[model samples]
Each structure stands twice: as structure tokens, then as C-alpha cells.
Target: MLVLLPPSETKHPGGDRDPLDLAALTAPELTGVRTELVETLVKLAGDVPASRAALGVSEKQDDEIARNAALWTASTLPAIERYTGVLYDALDVRSLTRARRARADARLAVGSALFGLVAATDRIPAYRLSAGSALPGLPTLRAVWRPALSPVLAALPGLVVDLRSGSYAALAPVPGAVTVQVLSERPDGTRAVVSHFNKAHKGRLARLLATTTAEPDDVVGLRRLLRRAGLHVEHDGDTALTLVVPAV
Candidate 1:
């Protein structure tokens, strides 16, 4: 099974290796669009004000723009190591054994506005861009991504568990891909969709999915796997799973 994850806004800075090489990333079909976005971002970085406006960043976050400016020449890190936030912190990839890490590299992929989709081991630079950001001379990200990305995702082998947030998922629709929803259950038995701790739960779920030895080719097997792992999983539909947690 393939586990699709969302890219985090917060990332670890700097790396010890060579710069990004789009040709080396998975899904070579996305290269054309990836090159276009990388070039656009590098050019936009030259204009600080425009870059800030386009990227939705404030003056205090000028360092983020600087990162974008260095996109071509900056050092790179594995896609999984680069993204850091509540979700990634919960993933705790560094704690995994080398064997498990290899499994993660094989099963995990991240949804990116800049690159479309990158494998966990793909080397990428620190750059600031969001799915909602509209570049000065380009069409909407959805318009630019859907036509190319959806087909690639739809043709992937086996089951697909998509854990991307709304905006990223909007970039490309994966037909027949299973989606996860996080909800909080209160003492009175009422439940509400989780907001603050959503990513943390999904992070744990992704970690479990990445490391498990069992291959779940359908939603039933997927639910069974999650349940055996102690998650409160419920079938919302043939292609949707709900994870219930104690209300905060």
C-alpha cells in the first residue's frame, strides 16, 4: 500500500548534501511542471515584496523568502527529514530502525505544491510555497496540477491511503484512494471532527502504515490493519476511514 502524506509549512533548515535534482525524484512525468515551478519561484524570490505577497508570508518570515531564493543552489535533505511540524514530530522517523526506514522510503510519499509528489527519500531543498498560493504569471495551482498529477496517482499500484489536508488534496484527485478523517469523542458520547491534534493523529497513523509488514490491498484489510494496531477505526465508506480519539 502507498501512504500519501501532506507537506508541512514548518521545515528543518539546511542540509549536508547536493542541491535538488528534479530528474532524480520519483514520478518523472511531473518533471516539466516541477521545472516550471522551481524556475518561477527562483525568479519571484528576486522581488522580496512580490514574493512575500505571493507566498503569504510576513516581514518577520523574510528568511523563508531567502530559502526560496536559494532553491536551486541550496543543500538538500530527504523529503521526510525536511518537513517538521506536529505531524512529523509525531512520526519521529529518526527513531525508526534502518530496516523500517527503508520501508518508509518505499511506502511513503508526500504531496507537494512545487513538485506534485515526492518519495520519502527524494532529496529536496527548503522552499516556501503553499497549495493556495497563486504565482504572478501562472494559472491556479489546481489548474496547473490536476491534469498531470491525478493520472499518475490513479495508476499507482495497490491501495492508496491519502492523509493530505484539504488544499493539497484539492491539487489532485485520486480516484479510489482511501481517505482518513480524525474525530474526537467526548464523555457524553458525542463526537466532533478534530482540528488542533488532527495532524498528530494522522502522523501516528502514517508511521504505523509505513512500518507494518502486512500489505493491505483494500479498505477492509486497511481497517483490519489499523484496528490491530489499536486505532479506533471505523469505515465511513468503501474509500474513507474515520479515526476516533478522546476529545481534548
Candidate 2:
């Protein structure tokens, strides 16, 4: 099964090894768009004020622009290692066993604003680009991405579990993908959409899915595996899942 994850804004900086090689990233078809976006970002970084305005960052974040400015020359880390946020913190790939880590690289794909989609092991540099950011010459990111990314995503060989948030999901829609939603189950047996714990639950779920020996080729098997991992999961029709966790 293929599990798609969303990239986080917070990242670890200054990798001392390697540079981004678009050909080395999975999905060879994305090279054109990747080159276009990377060049646009690097150019934009030359004008700090314009970059800040376009990226929706405050004056204090000029360092972010510097990161983008060195897009071509900056040191790189694997996609999983670079991202550091609530979700990634919970996924914590570094703590996984060697076998699980190998599985993670094979099964996980990160939905990215800059690179479209990258495998967990893809090498990338620190840069500032969110789904909402509009660069100087490009159309809406959704417009720039959907034409290429959607078809690539839809053609994947097995069950696809999409765990991306709205903006990133908007970049490319996977028609047959089964999506997971995190919910809070209250003491009174009430259920509500979870905000704070959403990323954490999804992170844990990603880890579980990545490590499982069972190959869940469809939603039923997916749900079964999740349940076996001890998550409170509910099958929501054929297209979605609800993972209920205790409210904090």
C-alpha cells in the first residue's frame, strides 16, 4: 500500500552532505515542474522583501529567504529527516528499527508544495514554500500541480492512503484514495473532529502502516491492519476512515 503524507513547515537546517537531484527523486515525470519551481524560488529569494511577501512570512523570517536563496547550493537531508513538526515528531523515523526504516522508505510519499511528491528517502534542502504560497510567475500551486500530480497519484498500483491536510490535498486529488480522519471520543461517548491530536494520530498511524508486515492492498485490509495495531479505527464507507482517540 502507498501512504501519502504531508510535508511540514518546520525543518532541520544545514545538512553537510549531498544536493537535490531531481532525477534521483521517485516520479521522474515531475522533474520539469520541480526544476521550474526550484528555479522560481531561488530567483525569488534574490529579493528578500518580495520573497517574504509572496511567501506570507513576516520581516523576522528573512532567514527563510536565505534558505531558499541557496536552494541550488544548500546541503540536503532525506525528506523524512528534514521535516520536523508535530506529525514528524510523532512519526520519528529515526527511532524505527532498520527493517521498519527500510519499509518506510519504500511505502511512504510526502506531499510537497515545492517538489510535488517525494519519497521518504528523497534528498532535499531546507526551503520555504507552502501550498498557499504564490510565486512571481506561476499560477496557483493547485493549478501548477494538479495537471501532472493527480494522474501520477491515481495510477499507483495498490491501495492509496492519503493523510494530507487540505491545502496540500488540494494540490492533487487522488480519485480512489482512502483518506483517514482523526477524531476525539469524549467520555460521554460523543465524537468530534480532532485538531490538536490530528497530526499525532496520523503520524502514529503512518508508522504503524509503514512497519506492518501485512501488505494491505485494499481498504478492508488497511482497516484490519490498523485495528490490529490497537488504534480505535472505524471504516467510513469505502473512501474514508475515522480514528477515534481519547480527548485530552
Candidate 3:
């Protein structure tokens, strides 16, 4: 579970000392966490396309994505260790149809979760055809769920909560779980810096800025918030508010 300082408590503590203590964290560590979160989600999405083309592929080709999802699930979260084994056993279930049904259900859950995460981050939904819902047969269900669910569960509400609160906590997923891919902004040079921060911890980037455009006290407020989440603040001087970001 992640613990956060309430906004009220952080903003108005009676101490005159540095409000948030983030000197303990280094820049590289913060950047690495952000990169890992994004990369993991991307790979998970790639594992499941759920596109019409994927569905149209020959059985051999169609199963390839499923196989990758299975492999990824096997490698990532420990909670899925038993579930993956169940999947293996289901493949040989006396009834071929039942075996297929089981696989599909699992896949569907994974897919929905991943899609949700993608949507939360990018503000765009990933899957057009599927929503998070119950499915029919086993194989068909796994086909829909497994790919997206893990990533979405890893990110979505949890990751976003952390981002908004300015905490850089990692979300651990069940075994066979997928990592979340963070949505990236375009390469165009935007001046505002989006950041996350609070009172308990401090961000390094916040400390690095020199006092200039904004008032000294405003910079201090920004610094206190970032230090809690190991985030930073940046602005092009024109934007009304400075950008607080946990990662670039």
C-alpha cells in the first residue's frame, strides 16, 4: 500500500526547515522508474493486438500472440504462477472446446486491464472492439482478457494516484502480470513542465532551479511539493503555472 501526506498537512507545516526532504533521491533513480513503467506497458500491449487482422490470421499465427502473452505472464508476476499452470492444464482439458474457452477468458481479462491503463495515460482508448466485460467460452475469453488486464491493473487508478500525489512508488503486479506503458507527449519543445510532488519527500529537479521568473516564495512552494514525490517543476515563463513532473 502507498502512504501519502495529505495536501493540507504538507502545505502548511509549522517548520521553517526545507518542507520536503528529497535530497536522498538521485535523478537517475527517478528517471529509471519512469522509463521502466512506460516500457513495461508498451511490451504488454504489443503482446495482444486484438485487431481484426489478428483474429483473421491462421490458427498458428493467431496463437502466436497468445503464446507471447502466456510467456510474458509467466515471466512477470508471481501471483500468476498458479494461473499459468492452470492455463497449461486447461490446454489439455478432456474437452478441446473447454480448453479453448478457458484460455480465451484469461486473455480477455488481461486485455481489458491493459486497455484501461493505456486509456488512462494517453486519454485515448486502445481497443475499439472490446470493453471490460464478461465473455463466453474459455478460449475466446482468454483471447480478450489476458493481454490487457495485467497492464491496466498495474497502472490505471494506482499508478495515476501515485502520479498525482507526487509519490514515485512502484506497483507490484501478480505473477504473469504486465507492466504499464506511460503515454508520451510529442517531441515538440513545450515549455511547461508537468510534475508531481508533495510534502513528505522532495524532488531533485525542483531544487536545481534558480530563482528568477517567479517569486522566491512560489518557487519554495513548488520545491516542497516535488520533494515528496521526487518530481520536478519547469516552465517557459509564459504559462500561468509551472509544470510539475515525476519524469520527463
Query: What does candidate 2 score on TM?
Result: 0.97
Clashing pairs in 2: none
Summarize candidate 2's per-residue lDDT along 1-248 as a digit string, tens digits: 88899999889998866877888888889999999999999999989889998999998898999999988888999998999999998899999999999999899889999999998888999999999998997899999999999888888888889999999999999888989988898999998999988898889888888888899888888888888888888998978888889988
- Residue range 102-181, candidate 3, lDDT tens digits: 33222222112222121101111111122222222223323434343334344432211122121111222333221211
Superposed Cα deviation of residue 203, candidate 3 (Å)? 13
Q: Residues 4-74, candidate 1: write the lDDT tens digits.
A: 99999988998976988999999999999999999999999999999999999999999999998899899
Query: What's the lDDT for residue 121 in model 2?
Result: 84
Clashes of each: 0, 0, 55
Q: Residue 157 of model 3: what lDDT?
A: 28
lDDT of 3 at 189: 41
Q: Which candidate gets the maximum lDDT versus the true structure?
A: 1
The residue pairs found clashing in candidate 1 are: none
Q: Please report, as a residue range, the 10-residue window in candidate 1 with the lowest summed lDDT.
A: 11-20
* lDDT scores in order: 0.94, 0.90, 0.26
Estimate the overall C-alpha local distance difference test score of candidate 1. 0.94
Error of 1 at 231 (Å): 1.5
Score residue 49 of candidate 3 by CA lDDT: 43
- On the 0 to 100 scale, the lDDT of residue 180 in model 1 is 94
User: Which stretches in model 1 have alpha-carbon errors above 4 Å?
Assistant: none
Each prediction's TM-score versus the true structure: 0.98, 0.97, 0.21
